[model samples]
Target: MVQARIGERLGLAPATVSEGVKRLVTEGYVEIRGARDVELTEKGHLIAEALVRRHRLAERMLTDILGMAWHLCHEQAEDWEKVMTPEVEEAILAKLEGEPTCPHGNPIPGTSSGIPWSSLEPVAALDAGAGGVLTRLLEDVELDHDVLKFLEEHGLMPGSHLTVMDTAPDGTILLEVQRAGTNPARVALGRNLADNLWVLPAL
Candidate 1:
């Protein structure tokens, strides 16, 4: 990642991001590569892997055990990841029986050796009548609480079957999803939202 991209993603000022990145480089957690890109060192990658594992495991516990809403799990899991000790992480993992992905369908680092799905494409890219199983809600979309809630309420979670019904002139994608115990229903998603949803094309 580049320093500017990091700043933009985290909504931080350039100066603040620069200072932080400098500190990280000094501490040996990150190394500057090409002109503006940053890469994690082995030590940094280990720490990151642990953090990501804990976060995703926490999300699983929150949603599968506490009945928390999928959209709300990420925020709460952020705190959980930071505070959990190794013992606590193990206990949670035992309870979850080594679940492979978070509620939004992103893989939990260290949980599996292989990627969960291949050849994923955004829902927005599907042509009318093309369909697939929704595989992932990208990180940006998972960050939006309202959007996550809306997706959850409309059965747009990972593994749901969805087909593109049509596309609007404004770039909105109309979709038909197979909700549990209900007939397939039409729903409309704007370009941004549709672009954030990844699908594994049905064979």
Candidate 2:
């Protein structure tokens, strides 16, 4: 994402985001092109992955240990992650017993779990009468609080069984969402939302 969008998501000013990115670039953590483009370097990716792993682990703890609602975990994890130490992370992992994904099914970075992420396709790719397990909420989509809550409220969360009932030309989709212990409900998803979700097809 670009600096401005990153600022928007973080509720920071563009100058503040730019300053941080500048520091990152100087530290060899990122590279910038033109006036607005920034990309993480290999060194940056390693640190980013480590932080993401901790953040996801923190989210899992909020859901699994504290019984926080699934939709609430991400924001809470944002703050909780800053307080987590390596020992704490190890403890959380022990409590989760190697469960590899966050509540939203995004994989924790360090785990050797055999999730075939490459096989997962965007929900927008499925045609009418096709279905799959909702396996992941991509990182970009997770940044939007309203959209995350909407997905959770509509039973579009990871592990829910979803079947495509119909697709309109404008890319709105009608789906039958089958979540555990809940009656199936039809949910309408707009193109933007559908394109962001990932599903693992039935073999």
Candidate 3:
């Protein structure tokens, strides 16, 4: 129920949210201990809570201390979400003693433990009207130059809008994304790249 509620609040589907819960279970981080509810095991609670802490703190640090625009901070925070170390997170918290939440008003992850959180699925899995912020892109050259160029030229970096237009029978995904103003640019994201790029639902 908690996972489902969080998903609803974030505008993501329950299935997608379940993926995160399942990963936590597989890693011994969460468990189903009763018939009526799911509970985070101690290990699960620590990791999940810590991630929330780091994410919120990072957002606060970026916008409050560094003066990043609200829209501009998501990408940087997304990258930091995966890489924040316990020590680094603590240092940030200590530096900003009164900070308790992200600029978006969500609670921060409480610890800096180096646990990797679950990421959103690829663009290919997305529905036509659904949009999300590109959170991360694994680096590759020969396999990804076209997609990268298309993304860069159109301003489709992490935190940019990614809306699927049409999916080809052969598996190519057509995407429409926002540029500098007004209309969005139309581009085709091939199957390989689409499968690798992960995103969080757009706010």
Candidate 4:
């Protein structure tokens, strides 16, 4: 992913995000080949994929079985992802009708199954009407408060359709996003919020 794009999605100040990426490089989780793009190494991919699986399953379990609100699911999933074991994850998947994606519709990476993580564009880059289901949220330790609030309020939770509607000189964006279902409501999102939303283009 591009540094600026990652920063925007994580709602992180550019420098802090850069430092974290640097540490990831030092730790061998990421490889920086040039000024613009970075890719995960094999070990990095393994860890990232595992986290992805945990995240999606947690979202599904929280929303579907536990009667949790969708906006609240991310934080809950974040905590659960840390303690989730492989066996537990498999059980959740089985209970959820073997669904491949989470409540917001982001695909869950399989632990023993093989599916590659695609490099995706952040919401900050797209023009109005450009849309895709959110597959992941970039993790930046110093993410902004406003961005997180916007995400929760607007249903830009993972698996939601993210459409870019505006962009500003300072890198702020305006977006239209919605959940999947008949007559799903569309909401506007500001740049701080948009920057933290990540997505793969729809097929």
Candidate 2: tens digits of C-alpha lDDT, residues 135-200:
988777777888888888899888899999999988899999999999999999998889888899
Error of 4 at 11 (Å): 2.4
Q: Is candidate 1 or candidate 4 better by TM-score?
A: 1
For model 2, the superposed segments whose C-alpha errors exceed 4 Å read: 1-5, 33-36
TM-score order, best first, reads: 1, 2, 4, 3
Model 3 clash pairs are: 52-108, 52-109, 53-108, 53-109, 54-109, 86-112
lDDT comparing candidate 1 with the true structure: 0.86
| Displacement of the residue 36 alpha carbon in candidate 4, Å | 3.3
Best model number under TM-score: 1
Query: What TM-score does prediction 2 earn?
Result: 0.89
Of 1 and 3, which scores higher on TM-score? Answer: 1
The residue-by-residue lDDT of candidate 4 on 1-203, one tens digit each, is 99998888867999998899999999999999878698999999999989878987997899888988765677678889989999998788888764456654456675333123556766766776687877666544114445556666667676677776666676666666677773455565555556655687765
Q: Compared with the true structure, what per-residue lDDT tens digits does model 3 show for residues 19-137?
A: 87778779987776554255878887877777666666676679777887655555567667778887887777777756354543333544332213264666778877777876555
Over 4 Å off, model 1: 113-117
- Which ranges of candidate 4 are over 4 A from the true structure? 111-203
| lDDT, each prediction | 0.86, 0.87, 0.65, 0.71
Residue 168's lDDT in candidate 4: 64
- What are the C-alpha RMSDs, in order, of all predicted structures? 1.8, 2.0, 11.9, 6.8
